[model samples]
Target: MIKNFTVFKRKLSHVCNLKPYKDTKWLMPNGNPTGLFVYNCVADQKVPVILSDPHIATWYSCGPTVYDSAHIGHASCYVKLDIVQRILKSFFNIKLVTAMGVTDIDDKIIKRGKETNTNFKSIAQQYEYEFWLDMANLNVEKPSIIARVSDHILSIEQFIKKIIDSDMAYVTPDGSVYFNTAKFPSYGKLQKMQDCGEPLSVLKRNKMDFALWKGPKPGEPSWPVSWGEGRPGWHIECSAMVSKLFGSQLDFHAGGVDLQFPHHENEEAQSCAFHNTLQWANYWIHVGHLSVKGDSKMSKSLKNTISIPELLDKYSADTFRMACLMSNYRYPMEYSDQMMQTAEETLKKFKFFLKDVYVYVNNNALQNGVYKDKLLDDLQNVEYQNLKFLKSDFDTASCINNLLSLMSNTNNIIKEKNGEYYPVPIILIADYVTTVLMKFGVTLKENTEDSVSNSIIDTLVDFRHTVRLNALTRKDKELLNACDIVRDKMKMIEVQINDSNKTASWVFTK
Candidate 1:
């Protein structure tokens, strides 16, 4: 393990170089963007994400607003990010400090509150709980710090005050505060905005200027303020949370590409201004948007979004994660029935393969066979390759391909061995595959239907044996009926029954 980790650390400089490097960032399988283009604070613009410390990484991701149930679009974004996190922790072995900020107080929350006739706080809490349950179901790693926008009001107020004092922000006659985009020259750099693209907010002098704080309003969630009673703006929540959690800077900041605009851009602007730092985060990472029917982005306006809970009802969490990862993170995911069905099938393949291994090892793999040396050689070869792949970026996709190949070869090997040879090699291969997959939070259990069928067959076989004893002693016509019942039951399950006058036996239909 030490040697394996060292091998990765040595290869790390090639990707996350501290010195400047420049290369065109291309989406490997397609000619698409990898969501956020690779940029580094140190050397080359071609570099993916270079850690600020170049040792351990500090990451901040903009979490959900939690006003309503999460959809497949949400799952795609989070799953891609979760895959990155898994790679970081499992392969790189870096000490990662990840912070995800949730906007528990927002306009959406208020609107949801009114619609549900529930308090905004209750709505936020309910959805927040739902969000986490869905995240956990999809195997997303929980953040080290969960900063609710509402919880960081004091910090946000202090941050806005500093920017205002610095003349980087301004307060309007209505007591609402706004970030002075005009005061910050490179204000829209993250968004690449050349001109104001939308209608102007009344509080700001410029269209690009965004709200820092809105003054008091009746029947709305707000915090006390000398400027007026109001809650933090959408962007400021993240800036304040990141500031409180990791000082002013982050090694990397991630979110869906949609956030690259005003949300992340605004967060970037306020952070740089408030911290007196050029760029608050070293790397800006993003995931691609998910579309429904490959037609439009999943939004409430179209009413085409599929909620996570809704999808989970038909497919497992692993299925969703698999489908999301099936496409590169940079490419948009189309929520097509075809994609889900494919993912479901892929999941079954993995589960079926795992169950086969489990049964073989428990039932047939008991022999201390003669092919120990050959088994050791094969296991060692695969282990080394798997570890090497785990250490490299863009290697995970290939890793899956390799596993499929191994499964194919193992199936042939099992047939040739006929349960006679060493099971060590097979055991080792399955263990390695499973361990590596678990990094992505893909857990495989024995095939449910197969397990259930086996259990039922066992019970039926025992019951038939007892019934045959009574029927035999009586020598009655019911003897044939009793045997017929067992045969019919077995046939229903596709289990072929073979009966002798003295006993009954069964095997799966060919």
Candidate 2:
């Protein structure tokens, strides 16, 4: 028998066996229902997620352990979460108070301590700084709080005390404390299994039971505690941080799928045990893995992990971000030369489309006020279309694809003769592209220039465009010859000029 739920506190929106509906007070404004759902790893289905408060959301993401440099595999998780937060804030209009816990004191950090012949704290900080720098480079949104376990030791100790007082945790003879999983009853539901990994120490009551606090180990960092001079276990750090930071519950708990087992499962068990609630986090959001071309997983043991610094050295961060967004967040994304090359090429294409639009819109600014085109009229309710895509479980890839397709047609208008060249439609199409790109950590730069030389070039290009457009219908040989002279002269300075119908565009190929 698989015991799925246990007795718990308040009426959670979507937790354990209880599924609140349209009438539930927690849904939205006066409990009005809305189209919101998540592919919950816990429920293993697309469960409706109605936050305790629609306007304000409390989210927590499990951060790096900080023992080693972050890999691209690590980038995949954080970037995906960043995009999720952006959509929640932008499209869903949710004000987010997001927290990410950094595991600065862990077994991995201790191992690095021995290797470096230094205290674990320094080693953890060194890599933590590097990890965050990489995150910034990748355009990941900064978390509202970066909670380090070492900094929150007091709160962690107090958390352990509460669990102990609840009788769900026991202090062993060695002064280490362990959460008795047998007491929680719904302990295995997150990972959806009953059998746990082999006990880390024989002091634990059951093989499934995990440590709330570990006893002092030789050469490892330790803090003075009532139970013992030791650090909190990996699982307990996240659990305690969630409580100390966001009370006993969260709207969302996010991490890689690898954490679903002993890490997240143990956190879920400890949370419910400490709070006496069957549901702790309302929604469990997990990101899939980033695999190499030939490998199934990127692992240090397998000698296959690709570091972030290595990737950043070769490709632009935006290209890598594009790859992440194009791939489904729920599925595994393979890192390959072909995949990355495709991403680089894709970004270049978007750059090219924008380049043409910028030149045509700004140069023809005066005439565009009266000029109208049927193709431009076809792009209707783009905001509505984008929002509709967002409402459907945030299919961001499709949202991007929609813009790309629209731009493809828009680009056709720019490229082909008799195609429309107007500012409003160009702005309309670019607006859609820019809106989606912002969600993916991409910014479309519109730098202002006031240089006299630039103004001269802009005026010259506008003159060439005007004359060539006039020459097209007038059938004046002398005016056509003047257009050719301007084109030839611009080309001499490495500028490429092309004429399609009434529009003459020039680009500095150099």
Candidate 3:
């Protein structure tokens, strides 16, 4: 493993020195993004993500509001983003530095606190903890930096001051601040709105203006500024955090598609105005919404959300991850019992196929066979090369289809050879499948592991058989179920069971 790690590092170093891909043309079977392309929400088209620096990429993702429990909708957004990040680092070899902001101070938090008779900060902290726990259960990777609104109040104040100083924002008489939409001509460019259809607030100068700071209300949390005490608005927190971390510009800005209008548009306007740059971020990536039945979005307020913990209790994290991967990132995914069932069955079939390959490799030694099937080999190479193109385009759904095709061809070869074919190509297919799936966070558990000796497994099997016989003689359903439970549990320890008419046998899979 150490030698392999050293070799991988050396290869990566060599790849860094090589010229980058000029277009959507891959470097052969290597899955480096011919050019990393992600859908830019404002541009409304897929744009290539080029690193400003040599090997590092900078990204900012809008995080949860942290006022309540995170649900499957949150899981869908974060897991899809996690998949993109993994591909960039592992396949594209681009080091990513990402920042996600937690809206720890918000109107929702204050409202919830008033209802529950808890402090707003306490409510925010509790939900924030729950949010991270949900992320872990779903196997969503954490961002490089987690900036909370409460932690960056000073920076946000400075940022608002900068916007006010630039004459793009103004301070209200009550110490509130508002972004002057008329001053910035490209204010609605992100949303591509021809008319500012947003309803006008009483204190704003124009109907299109949005709040930059909220003046203090009775019993609400407030931060002191030069004018008076107030809290940062939703849009300003993100702009402040992004500017603090990535400075003038970043490679990508990402969040759910719902944020594209108003939230994202407002963020873009303020960030660009603050930095005095034409663009605050080079590209924007938005994950499609996950909805419940019909057109209703899976949201907390709708009372239609499936929490991450609730889903994980019924299915494995990898199953849910695969469910997300089975759909295009830019498309909405419907969450249903049927969708989850399909995902579970699909994952199980893939795992069983991988287990068969592992069993064959263990039973037979590597050798060259006289009967070489040209079609199978050709299909294998073709599918392998196709992955580079599919993944480079951020077409993970098609990449999965590419893998399924490879697995089907390999299985056909295995059946035709009747367990007597060359092992080299077969193992290569297994390795390739494993590598692709690992990038998606679905690890195959067919690999060898440290386990008990063969004798110990034999002893356990004999004991289980004895119990089964006793239960059979007594016709006890409870005892019989217990015997079955033991057999099923053995699989967790890398033991396989084969049942006969009157008895069961076991083998050490490791």
Candidate 4:
């Protein structure tokens, strides 16, 4: 069963050290707009939100189409959103209800199913299962709700009917239903379509026309609705789902920035029209796209996309997650083997430092005494800074980097032996860091076996010593082979230990 941490409240204050924004801020320190505008009618008007409630936040993220394997771009968006949710919970003692809707009824799914000579439902199921596996490998927490479009056909139909009844949507000569951009009048606000160089009318019937319900084509999935056999449009799925899952008014709505234009804009129109409310979402957050080889777009047709499963298999999930965190959530990230290598090295260093701290804590506990207040204060300060960084627009990349710096500083302090024995504070810091890391989906298992832990450390130290000895004696081939063998053995042992520890933790918790 999934554990619920909603009822727990921390004693610490949730406020951050940074000055809160009183008005909409266009440019962040990195020159990117921290504020987003939602298109209510057809015109995009900038709306400012009040951030009074720090303890309650709800977020909705556009989930995968589930027709194929998830790529690095998909993984990037999820990681970014996960970081945002984590920050909200850790900093403000907030309980976030995050929903990620799976697009199980997309046109792409039907086409892919036909191409693969399989049933659409089967295809969607297979891909959705694969998505969950990928997410688990990456250590991503499951969303509060994993809603499927197929399961919400009734809600979609009712929502479409309501829009039709309200005259915001009309049926075409064919069975297709499109939202009347002329009715909304304030369309194209989110993406500033009118401000773009091209004439806004070129894209649709009016400046912001988009499909709400697509008429069924031969062999496509459809449901019996007011409009003959038809399916909900891409935008309508989100509008319907969000409204059904989290009332008409939501705390936050988020997706990739690429969806700002027709997708999210249309969703806003449909939602507001159906609910007769101006506030569709209190806050709109969009993650920047992920790039390949420094290019801003990565598509499967180009065959340049990287799959999450493939990346996880090549490097550990921790490395893949670390790479995503290296780039700010609002900035496009460039993926490369070099970046993955850097992330892997950084994770290795963190794990090494953590293991050292764990060993010291356990050894010090053998000679028991009261915890040191100074070390506790230092750890608490680091925790405070982490919360502060995260609460300020979910700046997890910066927060994690700062955490690594703290880990380095803590290691140095231990090395210097500047304080008396007070292992509880260090242990608490390690525990806190481990918890936060888990929230980011970094895999950090507790070490229960003293002998196994010592052996692993000894083997690593011995390998380092062997490298020095080999360098001095000029036995290059022997050193290389020995290092490879030792590394492989250590990996196998670590896997076994982790599996055992997971079982033990589960049993103990139960």
The TM-scores of all predictions, comma-separated, are 0.77, 0.81, 0.81, 0.76
What is the clash count for each candidate, in the order shown?
5, 0, 0, 7
Best by TM-score: 2
Candidate 1 weakest ten by summed lDDT: 26-35
Tens digit of lDDT per residue, candidate 3, span 223-261?
A: 889768989999899989988998987777889989987
lDDT of 4: 0.68
Flag regions of model 2 displaced more than 4 Å.
1-34, 199-201, 363-378, 445-510
How many residue pairs clash in model 2?
Answer: 0
In model 4, what are the clashing residue pairs, if there are any?
A: 41-186, 41-187, 42-186, 42-187, 43-186, 43-187, 44-189
Evaluate model 4: give its TM-score.
0.76
lDDT of 1 by residue, 1-510 (tens): 123543554455455453422222211111111212244222224344444343477889889988888888888888888887877777667678998988888898899889989988899899899999999877788999898887778898999999999999998987788888887876666654558645786656988788888887887777887677777778888888888888966777889888888688788889989998766776676787899764668876678888887887677777777786567675677888798888766655555456556545565345565455665576677667766654443345566666776776775565454446646778877787787778777865321255447667757875786677677778766785867786887778656555433334454431
Write the number of the candidate with greater lDDT, choosing between 1 and 3. Answer: 3
Clashes of 4: 7
Sort by lDDT, best first. 3, 2, 1, 4
Q: lDDT of each prediction vs. the true structure? A: 0.71, 0.75, 0.76, 0.68
Q: Candidate 2 has what TM-score?
A: 0.81
Which wins on lDDT, candidate 2 or candidate 4? Answer: 2
After superposing candidate 4 on the true structure, give the runs of residues whose Cα lies further than 4 Å from its correct spot.
1-54, 195-204, 361-377, 417-425, 446-510
